[model samples]
Target: MDLRFDHLIHAVSDPERARHAFADRFGWHTVAGGEHPGFATYNALAYFGLPYIEWVGVRKPEVAAERPFGRDVLRVLRAGEGPMQFAVRTNDIVGMADRWSRAGLVHEGPIEASRVRPDGVTLRWRMLFPAQEPGKLLLPFVIEWPAPDEVRLADLRQSGLSPDPAAAPRLRAVHAVVGDLARLRRSMDAYFPGVLEPCESSEQGRGVRWTCGEVTVFVWEPAEGALRRVLDTVGERPFLAEFERTAGVRTRTAADAARRLEAAGAPVHGLWVVTSE
Candidate 1:
């Protein structure tokens, strides 16, 4: 039941504008995504590898108001376009659900869902949403695709959807600015058991870093600083997505990072964060 960071969901007012924004911001190849059959939402996508960016917008307000996930998207968009959610890829979703039950964590389905691709092909999968807990950052939903993870990666390459890992700046981490970083770290241990590790305090603030093979999730709570202001403003949410820079990327101050994060609200393309390391 090993899980890896899968993709970031960015909520937007318009999916097409988001696609163009990603193209302009990172020079990433974007696709014109299609509608989800039941959710009343549509998407625009940009793939760096397995962990891609999904820009989702409400297509039918009445229908969207009926679905919980759709309502979540609408709530995020009301605050303006920004990173909305994250999900992990898993192979054994049933086992994961059992584990969650044993751990005393509440969860909703291994629900079956599908989106009809613009090319008229249907892509199906199952998702399990872990309820968000107090004092913890938002819990990432778990996704189990129809094929094995490697098979999906290969298919993405063959379909010309994902760029080669070495050539593209694949998503490296999702950084959350939240209150009580220590409590969030403890909560993650309950959900993920021992994968999260200690991270040093720096321009990124102080928190724990969780790695699930390919991508990392960082939770930070700074003392009266830019990151703290973010928590005060947005409450607990993922504020920045780090991507591997091809060259000349160095760390910046929290103020600079916060400024870049503000820039992310427009058009909903993820903000670029890279470390010299």
Candidate 2:
């Protein structure tokens, strides 16, 4: 199964607030995404071409806990906002389930789902969630869109859901904060298989890395500084993302939040544009 970085899901109490935070403070473009028809969530989208951010929010607290995705997000929102989960895309989601079975990983889905866009056009996809094991953190879910890559890219551009490819800065890597580095690597290795390696993130702490084309994922042990706070707050999650420095984005410009995260650790002002300061 060929897996690549897809959208990152940043769970929030309010989709609107998360959208404004990213656009007004972080200098990113976000658009309204429609609700999941049967799920207790809605979202706003920040499209960095194909690799995007989905700001998902709960619609009905009473119903949210009924689904696996909702239950996980609600579990983290109790600790306040953070990067709750991320996903990888593949052309074959069922094949992915087969891969997981062979690797001895438990999972759920390849279940069909769909949501209508704000423009009234309905979109559909399938998802496979790797069941988080006892005493271990969750891994990225696998998603498969019905359309081919080129066709989807064209649709995003023409429909204005995503900017032209070059108009957006590249997504460099995702910074994941985990409690046990060794355990997380074990899961990531089973999921990605034979691609994990060690990496040193100045802001996030020393951890392992695995790359899928242009996007890389770094799993870090929260340093004793500000990063430690993130661990205490959100438990194990991908707390931040780094992007290629673009016009509105800076290169470790010493912004207040950046300063604190810097003390915690990252590479060359690692978070670059992710902080609100």
Candidate 3:
């Protein structure tokens, strides 16, 4: 599978605010706006290291395209909240998609040159959705960038991005909570094969301890309860607070972060962050 951190998603109401917040507070640099066709979004890029952070905002109806993942993005936009989605970069889009298809996983076709980053870098890949059932968090979507180095992080450094290694955001880690845990692990095993060797976790939660250069993903077991508890824990002081301030967006604290987040009026389904290097 050769999976690694591709990017983390942050949902915002105002793209401009999110951009400035990242640059001024966290020292992350953002490229200009680019179109996300199906998702109807105007997105920008910020880097932790190689894999950049994708800050996406729903575009106005006038210039926007179809809403890809149904209307989940629009919901997040209403809330003006934290991490929305995460992606894994595969070495081969076609081969991986073929394998997934053989395994009976349902996904979208490999759109030739589907999405382009704001830096003028074009990404070529296909996306796969979980088959039959949906919302099982083990594997959200699989993406493979075309080989021969179409878009390297180094190429975008000239766009007001810093070369200093220390400028990267201090990402502690990334965490996800899902209704199913064991099934999620099994699904990953079937798809990615031997790629789970370095992961570590427990019953209370499922976590993959990242190597020195990789980002960790903590997938917790979800229970039937008010979404507030889940949101609260993720937004608890140190992480969400610092994120809002450092990222320069709203929702910097527990007291009102939830309220501000929900202000977008989107159903708070799930949230996660891709920590910086």
Quick one: best TM-score, which candidate? 1
Alpha-carbon RMSD, each predicted model: 3.6, 4.9, 7.6
| Candidate 3 ranges beyond 4 A from true positions | 60-67, 78-80, 113-126, 132-138, 147-151, 161-163, 170-172, 197-213, 222-228, 231-277
lDDT string for model 2 (140-222, tens) is 88899999878887888888988766656667667667778888777767776777777645653567666755677766675
What would the C-alpha RMSD of candidate 3 be, to one decimal place? 7.6
Ranking by lDDT: 1, 2, 3
lDDT of 1 by residue, 128-184 (tens): 888777333277888989988788889888887887667678677677777676776
**Better by TM-score, candidate 3 or 1:** 1
The Cα local distance difference test for each model comes to 0.73, 0.70, 0.50
Per-residue lDDT of candidate 3, residues 1-277 (tens digit): 4667666666666666777766664456666657667656766666655655666677765434344542545654444465666667766777877887888766665654356655565655566544424322335456665553334545545555434445555333454444444665676667666554323332223333222125544444423233245634543111121122133222212223333333323322223232221
For each of the candidates, give the backbone clash count: 0, 5, 4
TM-score between candidate 1 and the true structure: 0.85
